[model samples]
Structures are given as structure tokens and as C-alpha cells.
Target: MIANRAEPSMTETSSVWGTADVSSGKGASDENFPVGSLLISKALRPHVHAYYAYARVIDDIADCETLTPEEKLARLNAMEDVLLGKREAITRQDSMSAAVLRASLTRTGVPFETATDLIIAFRDDARGVEYKTWDDLLRYCKYSANPVGRFLIQLHRESLNAFPASDALCTSLQILNHLQDCQGDLIRLKRCYLPSDMLALAGASQEDILAGRTSPRLRRVFNTLLDGVDDLNRQASTLPSHIKDRRFRMECAAIVELAKRLTLRLRREDPLAGRVALKRTDAMHAALAALRGWS
Candidate 1:
């Protein structure tokens, strides 16, 4: 059925994900893939953007402070219904995100299960769940992060052999983001992605995280976590070479380089005192890394 659906026009994709008015969350930015990057084949950009838009809306709903948990769950469920074709899309203004995702699935042959998996993860976030172990957090990344890589691989028609590497890369990126946002996630959402077990090992606790201050114990925890992140980046660095498409290979290389750089920063800096973000120079370095295939 997906194979039979009509491909979406570039115009449609731009209207949904490229419009200036979309919320300014990380999902809305070119964090995953730079817009108009020559590394992506032109035909696939719209579909990629559609996926990004779908993800952005879900993230915004889960993170919205003013919305009750019940409200978030209800909205997420409605999105599931729309994706399943169990309901027509809601009113136009409210439904654009879901509509775009549906179109993307149809046009790109990306499985609906991918989007549904993301919803499951967002639902977990809405429930204010905290991971108890490294394994637990990795499991969460299975739904929250790996699906995006799987979708991109499917879009590119890459071999299944590439999946393991992709999964490692995606999961690592998710953990990197969690480490970077540990303070804000605790302060605003009361959600801690850092494993409780690790915190214990570091002689830290949720109370310390809530205070948004890095104690000596917390610093030790961060350092240990950064080591793990470095290992993940090393594991993921091999993924670019596995990609069959040269351009996509470069893209994959760039992502690995960027993640490596970010992890390095996370290792040295205190997340509570300030934010860690990629600079223009970092972007340039990533681009060069991509070109050189030097993940």
C-alpha cells in the first residue's frame, strides 16, 4: 500500500517543516541533517523534513509545561489514531503535524511503526519516568532515538547490515543530549535520564540533580558517563564506511564527528552552569570531517 501512494511534492514538505513559525525546539533545527545539504539527495529532503516535523510536534507536546500529563497523553493518542487511519485528521490547524507524517510514511515507504515507537517514548517522557540503570536508558533510546536512524536508512534503501551501527550512533547521540540537558530536564520536567545506578556509584542523588549544581560526586558521574559516550562514538564511527551511498557516507561521517566533538565538550564542561552547543567553527570542522571521511 505504501508503494502505491503518491510522493509528496517539495512544496508540501516545506510548508510543514520549513515554515518559520514552527516551534524552536531542537527538533525544528538542522541538528539531524542540515537543510539544503548536498549530502542528501534532493528527492529525499522533503520526506526527511516531514519526519523532522512529526518528531518536533511530539517533542513539543511532551515538553509543554502548561499541559497536564493527561492532556499530553490524549494528544499523543490522537496522533496514533490519525497515523493508524482509525480517525480522519483533526481540524486543519491542529492536525498538520500528523498529516505531514502520514504523507511522509506514504511517500517514503517508511513504516508507520517508526512513528509509533517514537510516540511510545514520548509517552514515557510524559509519565515523568526516570531510568534506573544504563540498560534502562539504552532501552528508552531504542524507541526515542534509533527509530530515526532506521527511518533514514529505509529512506535511503540501505542494507540491514547498517542497522547495528546506526542504532549505536543514534543511542549515543540521545545519551549525549541527556548529559547536556541533565540540569534543565531535572529542573523543569522532573525527569532524569541519567541512570540512578550511576548516580549512586558517583555518590550523587536526584536531590543533587534537582539543585542544578555539580558537586564533586556529580562531576565524577559526568566524567564516567562521558567515557561511555566516547566509547559509543568510537563504535558509531564505523557506520559511515558501511553506507553504500557516498553522499550519505559523508553525512554519516559528519554526524559522528559532531557527536564526538560534543561528547568531548560534555566531558570537560559543567552542564549546570551553562549550555553546550556546537559553534560555527565546529560545523565547519564537521563538514571537513565529512569530506575527508575521517569520522
Candidate 2:
């Protein structure tokens, strides 16, 4: 998720997403999946980039610091209106990117509601909401992460039969991101996504999170969460087999591999000390796994 920030100047050309570059540099780097990977057909690349741009812009608004909560809500509402056909575009500055996203949805026949669900999640972020249980966190993933996978699946014309596996894969990736960025989310945004009940079971509190240290209790809590993530990774391992499209199956395999690798790293590394991320070599391994269609 990106915070309030301007797009990077280097991507200002229309090369990246078939629209003006609306990416905040920070957001681009934070994305875990290969947005323009070769595994995706060339025809689908534009739609993928458009979807990513829309998500990036919305996340930036929710995460932006200079804007008040009220302002963020207003901006999100305006974007939602555009997505829902209530308006044409956000502003002259955003019109091209907005048009590209709208066109992609129209061409792919993906429902506007998919994008709106993401808006709902961003609204929660703007309001500084917290999760009380693992179920509550999953509900958040429903809006925040699952829709991206759903939209891509729809774009590929895959059967709805694949959705369950897609959801598991997407949710696992979301959890991996949450675990990796827990420290930053707490320190920078005053947000915590870890379930309160689990923290309590581990004898940890929100204060322990604020202290920015990995105590034994906190480690136990994270280990418990890691177990759940591992389960999801296993569930998602079947996704590639379920996908009918060969290219999409490869892409799914790659994402699952990346998620599995990241989950392993999160299991060992302390989030508070520094960020945990995949190296370029790790990404290459994922790509090769995709090429081989390895689940």
C-alpha cells in the first residue's frame, strides 16, 4: 500500500501503463509481483498495468500524510464515483490514467464492484481501523487483496472454479506483505494489522508493537501467524493446476513460489530490525519456476 505521494518523474512517459505514469516511485518498488512479466500475454499487459495504476493511486491517497482524513475520504469518493460511472474522471491531471482503467474494465468485462471493494478497503485505511481477530483480518484481505486476483482471473476468462485457489494465493501474498511491513506500518501510519486476539494469546499488547522490538512473546505471535500463512501457501499451490490458460497458470505458479519464499524469510527475520524482501536472484528463480509451470 502506498501513502500520499506524487508520481515519479522517470515514469512520466506513457510507456508503462498506456497512460500517463501515475506511479509514486515508492509504490512501484513495493509491488511484489511482476506487473509486466513475460508470462502474461502481450494483449493483457495494458489491462494489468491499468489495474495496477488504479490500485497504486488509491493506495497513495489512503497512505498520504499531508492530507487530513477527511480530505483522503473525499479523494477516494471522487475516484469511486469515476469507477462507478457517476463521473467521467478525477481531474485533468488524472484523466488519462482514469480513462485507461475504465477502458480496461470495460474490455475485460470485469465488474466495477471489484474495484469498489478495493475502495472500501482504502476507506478503512483512511479511518485508521484495526482488526480484532484473524477473521477480521481476512475480511480486510477480501477487499484489499483478493480483488486483484479476481480481476486478473476474469481478464483471462478463467472459470469461476479457480477463484477459491486465487483467493488463497492473493490472501497469502497480502499476509506476507503485512508481516514484512508490520514495523513500518506501526511506526509510520499508526496502523497494526496483527489480530488482537492472537497478540493477547501470545501475551503481547499493542504497546509491545509500538516498542519496535521483537520480544519472545511477539516472536511466538508471529510464528503462529506464519503457520497460517504456510497453510495458505499450500492451499494456493493448487491454483496453477486449476487455471486453464497456460500463461496464466505459469504466472500463478510464479506468484505462489514468490509467496512461499517470502513467507520463509518472514519466519526467520525480525520485521522491526529492517525490511525483508526478495533479492533479484530470488525473483529470477520465481520467473524460472513460472517458465516451467511449477506449482
Candidate 3:
């Protein structure tokens, strides 16, 4: 369970919460990593897809630039309502995503928090909340990233003993994503996931984030975050071994390896120059990782 999670502050469910589909058109293929990959059993794949679709819907609402904060919060509340059976979905996509996931969770007996907790983080994103310290960033991840891992764990009936390593892995991946998209986030959303104190400690300024390339001080900030990612990867490397399921273990191993690989790329390359990402060939390394973890 996510202990001591702060409730998001939003207006009471508006009487007339408007419905509009604001999907970014990002399918499973548009993600940074695989979703419902071959590692998961065919039978269990739909539940995973259902959960991903719900997440993507709420996520798109938070990131949609056109919606005001009130509109975003209202849409998010509507999603929660549909997800928890408080109301029926007004939009077709909402019915397909949130209402479906609600039914799926009822059948599977997974905790609703795995899906609802995401709204908290997305609410923060909608409000343009910024972080001050690494701990603050991790707290954001508690809502944003950690629940995804927890959902998988619960879906597979894994022990909570795996939570520590899983949280580390998820948080690292989230931070790496922040680093990779830092420039574009600033340009589009005016949001910076990079800890402001870390930037000040390294003598880097927000101005450096928008520049054509990473400045020296900004590079130092990136390296510091990467160093933290190194520690996280070390922690997350144990996640596969902690799992009881064979294929899921392989999936965790591959994801951990991808997180590690992306960390290395961020260290070696400049994200400000362009999007630093894994190539199709990187799948070979991920496959080998899965094989090594197979028992």
C-alpha cells in the first residue's frame, strides 16, 4: 500500500462535468517501452491492455494543453467515477477504457488504488506541480510510476516483498523519462521534472533546459540524476529474482535492462540534442536479459 499519500486538492465533482475525448492517439506502440509484450501469457494480456487503456485516457487528459485545470480535474473525476462505478461513461473511449477496467478489476480482485492513485499524479501534472528535491520527485513517482508496478504485482498475485525493488525500478524509469523529455516538456508544458534544488546545487539554470544543447552545468545536473539512476538500477536488478512467475520475471528483467540501457545512453548522449532512445536492435539485449533470468 502507498502509505501517507496526500489527497489531491480539486473542486467537488462539478454538476455538469463536460465530456470530450482528448486522446493523444498514443497506442501501445507509441510508448517508450513494450506494453503487453510476448512475455505475458495470452489469457492475462487483456487485463493488462485494459489497464493500459485506462491509464492512457486519464494521462491524455492531464497532458492536453487546451483544457483548463478545472476542466482537467473534472474529466479526471469523471474517469474515477466511471472506474469505481459512481457513474456511467459519457464518451465512447471512456466506456471502452475506464468502465472496462472497472469490470476487469472486479473480476480479477486487484486493488483500485493501482488505477485511482494515478489520478493524483496526473492532477499534479495538470496543475503543473514542480519538484524541489529528489525526495519530492520520488513522492511524485509514488503516485505516477510506482502504481504501474504494483498493478502488475497484484495482477500476478505476487508478494508485497517485491515492492521495494519494483518501486526503485519504476521510479528510475520515470526519472529517465523526465530526463529524455526535459527539453520538450519545457517547451510544450513549461514543466520540469528535474529537481530545482539539484539544478541550483549544480549551478544550472532553467534557461539551460531550453537551449540547443546541454550546457556544462546542466550536464552536471543530468549526471547527478544518472548517478541516482545507477543506484536505482542496482536496486531494481533484484526485481526479476524476486518474482515467482517465470514469464513475468523475464518481463521484469527485460524492463530493468531497458531502464539500465536508457540510463547509460543519457550519460553518454545529450537529450537536449534530440530524443535519446533505444533502437530496435536493443530488443536483442533485452531478450538476452530475459533468457538469463529464466530459471
Structural similarity to truth (TM-score) of each candidate: 0.89, 0.88, 0.91
How good is model 1 by TM-score? 0.89
* Candidate 3 residue-pair clash tally: 0
- Give the per-residue lDDT digits (tens) of candidate 3, residues 1-295: 2124322111211111223368554455556778878899887777787787678778888888888989989888888887777775553565447767876788789999999999999999989898999998999999999999999998999988999999999999999989998998888878899999999998988899999999999999999999999999999999998899999999999999999888888999999999998876677888899998898
For residue 188, what is the lDDT in candidate 2?
78
- Name model 3 segments beyond 4 Å from true: 1-20
* Stretches of model 2 off by over 4 angstroms after superposition: 1-25, 90-96
lDDT of 2 at 199: 96
The collision pairs in model 2 are 3-63, 4-63, 4-64
The digit string of per-residue lDDT tens for model 2 on 1-295 reads 2223343222332543433323233546677777767778988877777777778778877887677789889878877766655666533434435555766787678887778899899899999998999999899999999999999888888888888889998899898889888877877788899999999999998777766568899989889888998999989988888788888889898999999888888887887777888878778878887887844
lDDT by residue (tens digit), candidate 1, 28-125: 35363354367889888877777777787778778878888998899888877766666666433224667767877877787898888999999999
Give the clashing pairs for model 1. Answer: none
Leading candidate by TM-score: 3
Worst 10 residues of 3 by lDDT: 8-17
Which of the predicted structures, 1 or 2, would earn the higher lDDT when compared with the native? 2
lDDT of 2: 0.78
